[model samples]
Structure formats: structure tokens, C-alpha cells
Target: MRVAALDDDVEELDLIKSTLRAIGHDCHVFTEGAALQRELRRETFDLLIFDWHLPDTTRPEIVQWVRNHLQARIPILFVTNRRQERDLVEGLAAGADDFMMKPIRVGELAARAIGNLLGNALKFSREGAWITCAVEALGVDWPVRVEDEGPGIDEALQAQLFEPCVRGRSGTQVDGAGLGLAFVRTVAQRHGGKVLLDSAPGRGSAFRLVLAQAPDAPPPERGQGEAPA
Candidate 1:
């Protein structure tokens, strides 16, 4: 498989590249997130490995860009030294398939999963239609919503929409395995939360993923910083 590994540490990048090469895979290394973003515009890779903190951009910003711009369901992994549980949650919520702590292990890079909610909205919506994603605190739960102006899902299809391999009529027009919603459901459940869908024919669709805030998590300040995306 072709892989792209991004990290500011030259030694770490070399280690990842050599390990991947030893496993008979091609690896492209980048020192800066912007450089990787530029390469992604013209090149395609089977997997992407990112460091949580980058010099030019953040993991979430770049990950969101990849999901929205590339529209590819490529798996992404984060290999970083940020070991906080909240860090892992934030990383996965940012659309990464997996998160790993550094002190790189040779065999630890093998895992796969993907979050394609934004990509699906982009694919199913009409050209120039509006798509908005928002994150807000609702009591002890954080609700992340992605709303799009597209052909609304039918009530009958919504019943089984999150089931693996199930798709709506409009889904037939798109190219996917119908596992996106299922993956979302899995992630939500694993986080002690649930995913909800609200839609009807012609009224568009809204997906809400509500995650429970950790008991030790600090409460959000009223107007201090921007809400996490």
C-alpha cells in the first residue's frame, strides 16, 4: 500500500518510512502539513499518518480539509506523543481512523477504520448546496452536527440507515460500500453516545453525534475560545 507520513521530527519520519519500506510498502514523507496538502491535490495514497501537532496547521483542520476536498474514504492514523484520553477522543472526532502514541513500534501501524459523514454529504448534495458543521455543548454532552441541503432521506430508509451495508435509494447513485453510517454509529456507541438522523423527503438531512463529556473534563467557558469543530 502507498502511505504518506507527516511529522516534523526527521528521525521519526525516517523510522516510519524505513519500517513501511521494510514491510514492502511505499512511503512518502513530509515535514510540514502544507507540503503534504499540496501533494495530496495531485497524488493519491492508500493511507495517511499524521502527527497531532504540526507547524503550519492543526490535525483537525487538515483532516477536515482532506475529507471535504479530496472526498476520498482513505484511512488516516495519528502517531503522536499526546497520550491524553481527551486527545484521542478529539483526534478520532476529527475523522482519523486510529490514534497511536509515539516511541514508534514497527507492527503498531496496522489498523483501519474511517469516518465519511462529511464526504457523504458532499457527494449526495447538489452542486453549490449548503453544508454546515457545528459543535456545541449541550449540558454534559457535546453535540456535533452536520447539516446539508440535499435530497432528504426517506423515513423507511432511515430506519436501517446505520446498519452495515444498508443504503438509501439516493445512495445507489453514489460510490461507497454503505459502511459510513455504520462506522459513525460504532464510534458514537464506543464513546458512550449515540448518533441520530433527522430528515424527510425534500427537506434535507441532519446528523447529530452526541458524545458524553468526561466527568473530569473542564466545563466550556461561555465566550473564551472557539468551539471544537
Candidate 2:
């Protein structure tokens, strides 16, 4: 998962970055809230981890910006020393999905971050997180296939997978505009090709994009008396 972590303490931020990296997550750390906000405008993250008392901004302000201005559904997890009942309630009210106390355990942090992104395959992927892409001859055409070992899309959702703005019920909590498959379909159709999905629940998914191969170019003409080189 791609994650953004905000903390003013340099040591804490480094620990967060190293810990997340060890668990196969990419982390972008920021020392100030403004820098984090600036990055938020330019990129998308699967999760956001913020310290409650940032130097330039408060937790409430950042949460409001994410919920109101950005209007993003990206899950947020807060890390702070605020252990009071009121503090927890206020953070939750500000749109944080979960919170952790200071002096975090690396294992627990990794688990929580993964859980927020997706549930099972994301957190405990036994395949060790890999995607395979290949192009193979299919009759006179070539089919490019991308396969992932993540949880498969539901059979019912597969029918509308390429439709714009349509998201599977299982992925409604995921952060996306649901245009990826739609764009893929458009590109495949433009190339006199089609897209296919072969998947079943818990069996993973493979997306095949088949495109007709261009006809072979005619052999170059040679003079009648030309000698072989």
C-alpha cells in the first residue's frame, strides 16, 4: 500500500518509514502538515497516518480538509500520545478510522495499516505480493495478461467491471474513481481488441487484453538480375 505519514519528530517519522517499508508498504513522510497537504494535492495514497499535534496544523483541520475540500475516502489512521477518552472521540469525529498511541509496535502498526487498505490478502498475502504480466500468441492475435493473487472480484461484479463509475460492493471502501477498467476497455476496443476476466472467488484474477496482430509486411522487391549478397 502507498501511505503518507505526517509527524514533526524526525526520529518517529524515520521509524514509521522503516517499519512500513519492512512490511512491503511504501511510505512518504512529512515533517509539517503543509508539506503533507501539498503532496495530497499532487498524489493519491491508500492510507494517511498523522500525528495529532502537527506544527502547522491540527488533526481536526487536516481531517476537515480531507473530508470537505478533497472529498477523498482515503482511510486515515492517527498516531499520537492523546489517550484521553475525549481525545479519542474527537479524533473519530474528525474522520479518523483508527488511532494508535505513541511508542508504536511495528507489527501492530503494519497490521492496522494493511487492514485499513483491504482485509485479508492485503494484510496476509502468502504469495508475497507479486503481479505478472505477459503477452502470448492467441491464434492470429496477441493477448496481454496481467495476473494477481489478491482476492478475486465477485462474479456478479465482473459483468459491470468495465463500466464507468461502477465499483464492486467489496471494493466500495477502496479509494478509486472506478475508471481504470473503463479506460482499459476503451483502449482495447480502439485497437480492435477486447478485454476478458477469468476469476472466481478466492481463486485470484487474470485480465487478458487481446489485440489483433498487424499483417506481416510484404518482402522487399529485388531487381531481376540482382545477385545474393
Candidate 3:
């Protein structure tokens, strides 16, 4: 993916650039809003990352400009040091798809969440079965759905599907540690959201990861000895 990142701080820009590149994305860094805008006029990018504060602009002005002027529905993410509720509101109100604090680990969280979902879908579904992935906007939440035409899950197992090391009856047929869904649940809850499953004996499973449009607070500290399931 081609990504455009704007930040006035040199160190922050370097961090953003390196992190994106490490995840196989082409990242273009800008020290000023004008430079980024100039590039946007002549080039295209798959994603945009913006800092809440810019030396020449107020909060989210560039984001507003992009929403107002651009025709494409590109995903925009805000990575900044600001943590106030109103700052989050303003960023989302200006049309950012997601908001996160500074000192981020780049795409690790998203990659892990979605990766596990897709991996499970592939594992559970029979060979050549259809697996669909989609993103939908729901009022103040974004839900990523992964639907698979696999042997549907039982209600008894669904209840404990997100629990660590828990698996369905069919789990024994598949090679897994039963940790994927648990990790997905943890990631969603940390963002003040949740993971939901829709399935039945005959109907295939659809896993929906719903995340808040903007974070309400900083991620809670993990408990001592906590680890991914």
C-alpha cells in the first residue's frame, strides 16, 4: 500500500516511515502540510496519516481539506500525542477513519487482528470454499467482517470461542493453538469495542470485529504475566 504521512517532528516522521516500510508499505513522509498537499495534487496514495498539530495549520485542517476536496474515499488515520476527548471528537468529526496516540507500533495491531481472522477463516473452511472479507461503517463504529463457508460452529462452542485455548469440536481436526479468536477479542476490547460471531449448525460463520470510530481513552495497561492466547 502507498501511504502518505505528515508530521512536523523529524523523529516522529522517521518512526512512521520506518514502521510503514517494515510492513511492506510505500510511505511518503512530509515535514509540512503544504508539501503533502502538493504531492496529493499530483499523486495518489492508499492511506493518509496525519498529526493533530502542524506548524502552519490548526487541528485537522488538512484532514478537513482532504474530505472536502478529494473525490476518493481514502482511509485517513490520526496519530498524535493529543489524548483529550474533544481532540478525538474533532479528529473524527473532520473525517478521520481512525485515531491513535503517538509512540505507535505502526500496523502491528491491525495486521495481527485481521491476519488472525483471515487465517482462521481459511483453516476452518473446506478447500475451495468461499471466504469473504469486508469493512462496513456503522454510525460510530467500523466493523470488519470475515465470512467463511465452513462447517458452522455450535452454539455451545461459540460462547467460549473467544476464551483462551478454547476450541470447538471440529478444532481437533484443524491444526491450531485456539489462540486466534482470543487475541482478536482482546484487541477489540482494548479499543473499547468487541468481537462478534454469527453462525449456526448449518449456516457458516461470520466474525465481526467492531471498533470505535475514535478511541475514548488510552489503551489500558496489560496485567502482569498477560499474553496473547
Top lDDT hit: 3
| Candidate 3: pairs in clash | none
lDDT of each: 0.74, 0.67, 0.75
| Superposed model 1: Cα runs more than 4 Å off | 1-115, 169-172, 219-229
Across 1-229, the per-residue lDDT of candidate 2 in tens digits comes to: 5789998899988998997676456799999888988899999887788888777888888988888857568778888887899999999998898788887643343334223223323322344665555545656666656665666788898898776556553432554545446546655565577778887767666677665555672322322121111
Residue pairs with clashing backbones, model 2: none
**Whole-model alpha-carbon lDDT for candidate 1:** 0.74
lDDT (C-alpha) at residue 39 in model 1: 95
lDDT of 1 by residue, 1-229 (tens): 5789988889888988997676456899999888998999989887789887776888889889889988677778888788789989999999998777877432231111113666667777887788776667778986767777778898989999987567664443776556567657755665678889899878788888776667888754432221122
Clashing pairs counted in every model: 0, 0, 0
Q: Please, what are the lDDT tens digits per residue for candidate 3 over residues 1-229?
A: 5789888889988987986576455899998888888899899877788888776776567877787777776678788778789889988988887777765542457667877888887777777778887776666776788888778888888898887556664443875445568768867876678889999876678888887755453443322221111
lDDT of candidate 1 at residue 51, scale 0 to 100: 81
In order of appearance, the predictions have TM-scores of 0.48, 0.50, 0.51
Q: How much is the lDDT of residue 183 in candidate 2?
A: 45
Name the TM-score of candidate 3.
Answer: 0.51
Report the backbone clash tally of model 2: 0
